[model samples]
Target: MNASDRTPADLLRSALAADPARPLVTFYDDATGERVELSVATFANWVAKTANLLQGDLAAAPGDRLALLLPAHWQSAVWLLAASSVGVTVEVGGDPADADLVVSGPDTLEAARACSGERVALALRPLGGRFPQPPAGFADYAVEVPGQGDRFAPYAPVDPDAPALAVGGLELTGVQLVGRARADAAELGLAPGSRLLSGRAYDSWDGLSAGLFAPLVAGGSVVLCRNLGELSQEGLDKRVESERVTNTAV
Candidate 1:
């Protein structure tokens, strides 16, 4: 695919077609002693299922705003790509009440309830297990998403010029997002096959770029660390060595 005509979804599709077996996201939660690795095909499967859930069940339309109230975990990454594939606008940490749908973690239960639209709650448990019981007003993501289709086709074509993401006071179209990510990947010295270890939170431009978009654009992968403060320098070093990380962003 030509770079000028590419979107984030296009990048992901290319990666899947090029090397479906390559590791796409490696997640670590130091506090919980959790480590999970998802290959490109596995990650794409999750994205497709979630995208189908959004489109088929939730009835999310292009340009619809989805409030993402979650941390920098693997599931959060899945939702990001799912929303992008369906041409939904992701508002990271946005006010749930104003969004067309809300996807939240246990920590944001209250805020998620305040949202009048459809709601999905992730347990964020190890292995992405289902919640003990469904959260009051929301569907359990683990319970619902798995039953959705494994392939996704948006109801309408995703416009490259449509708004795709809004975070940290920046609103970006699909093309702009991919272009910026490509530029940022070059600036960060990311090359194909690079593995980037990022302990930074996804609350700002720097963190999001390094932790997600840049890696996708550069045909690299990310080792995303949540609760990074819980790991000592020695632990971090060991993780970097074990994961064979080629770059670091914190």
Candidate 2:
């Protein structure tokens, strides 16, 4: 782990500095037969735009709580990093009523309305499509995100000691989050440039580390798979070979 990396966003910047063209997150939805590969540059661009939207359009400030009501998809990963970039505390599957802002998927829009603050909804379609009819009372993330600035600069610097994540009944500061991710990476034997295929949900700390942060801090990549259980053993083996996966967390 890079000793200079004090936050998750720092980890991403270090990855970008290492090799912008390297594949960072490759997402697959077995149920929909969808696959999308994002290089470090591409993923960081998305993170920047989303971060701008979160801070500028949504009026989010450091220490603000955001309820992220999305599944373990690639876009969810993008939102995770975006929130971290701006120092927003992400609550995985958190209660909407208590959040200062909320991001929801199509499946959780109804529940996310409980948030009295700003709300954004994601269609979660292939290529990040928008809702056929934009949901009422919530901005379409795909629609709004495209117009945001490509470069993000948070108005206030992030505090590493401040709370950054809350999930699985555990709350961690930025320092704690990155530190744990590094530990998990070592425990999972992930090496630099390793490709990890993760089939874990994002509702717990284990899933967050394995699916996103661990590989990231390890200078590796993630093949995030949804509904992977539906794949046959042979199919899964073929995928492992095709993606050159070195580790797995399911």
Candidate 3:
């Protein structure tokens, strides 16, 4: 991570300053045969729009709790950074009823309705498509997010020392989260411009670090694969080669 970076949003800004045109995330869903790549600028644009949706539409404030009930897809990555930018605490796979707001994927929409607060749903379709019918009691993320502003400025500044993530029974401040991400990036042998291929779920700290934060802090990109077990060795090898992956955390 950059020495000047405090929050995850700061890290993203540092990366954007470094190279906005370079690919920051390459996502593939073996089960659906889908592939998508986003440069730093493109990824940050999505983050900005999503952050606007969270802060403006959902009326989320700093310290608000967000239950993220999504998988390790590109949209999930967008939501993570967006929540961080909004200064909202994110709880991965958290209980809906305990959250001030819940963001869920198609598979978890029914369960996400337990949240009495605001709810957002992602269809997880290719190219970030919307659901045919909006789920009841939940805003369609793909639909609402696009209409949001391209740029975002948090009404309230995020506190680096404030809680930013709650996962695996552990709570971490933004500073601590960045510290851990830097450490994980080192342990995973990531370097500037490195591409790390990860085929892990986003339910645990390890998976989260590998799939998202580590690469972010390392000034590298991620090849995030979902349902990777379904891919043949030949296919996986081809993907690794095509994505120019230098490290693996599958």
Candidate 4:
């Protein structure tokens, strides 16, 4: 099958169809200081709604760029999928001015987008705590309103062969990523309903796809450390014990 024929959304959708009430992501953002989670069904709706909101709010044209400052993980996953579904390019900013649209993360959004200078037309950022105090000109992505549509339609049918990501200027195909994620899940031994503890950064491709998306799609549990970079062994131990998590091969 072609790359467009498969995607993380496919796996997520399957899981939601099987059981929408199940939690697809569980994590605490260090910047937000709030523990949040989204059940499979809620996540699906969130993705669709976000797609509609992004499309409407940004007026993103087909193949337009939406630079993502958010790291990879559960929350990032939904945004990535939503952006893809709506035909907006998901650009993880490695260099400033590399994107047409720029959205910054709690820690790095401001500096990251600063590289863009005046190149970026639309800047979407979350509000509240560390929501990057933009210097004069920038819009809050979180403030963007979700459109009236209850669902989203693909702006253009995504070809599995189309580049899903850019790494140092090289395009990575969507199908390749899906395959890699699946393979990693199998190698890690994750299956439906498995419990996982990750004190790792989801910014990396491997970590985001395998550590977060893989387990969630497989009907598993994901426990993320809010301070992943500073996570202590003791903290992970406590989380395991308190949560009654059973370790598996994955």
How does each model score on TM-score? 0.98, 0.99, 0.99, 0.78
Rank candidates, TM-score, best first: 2, 3, 1, 4
Candidate order by decreasing lDDT: 2, 3, 1, 4
Best by lDDT: 2
Q: Could you tell me the lDDT of residue 152 within candidate 3?
A: 96
The number of clashing residue pairs in each candidate reads: 0, 0, 0, 7
Candidate 2 error regions (>4 Å): none
Candidate 4 lands at a TM-score of: 0.78
- Give the per-residue lDDT of model 3 (tens digit) for 1-250: 4798988899899999999999998999989999999999999999999999999999999999999999999999999999999999999999999999999999988889899999999999999999999998989988898899999999988999999999889899999999999999999999999999999999988999999999999999999999999999998899888788899999
lDDT of 2 by residue, 131-224 (tens): 9999999999989999988898989999989999999889999999999999999999998999999999999999989889999999999999
How high is the lDDT of residue 147 in model 1?
A: 89
- Tens digits of per-residue lDDT, candidate 1, 118-217, equal 9999999999999998888899999998888888898899998999988899999998999899888998899899999999888776788888889988
What stretches of model 1 exceed 4 Å from their correct place? 1-5
lDDT of 1: 0.90
Roughly what TM-score does model 1 have, to 2 decimal places?
A: 0.98
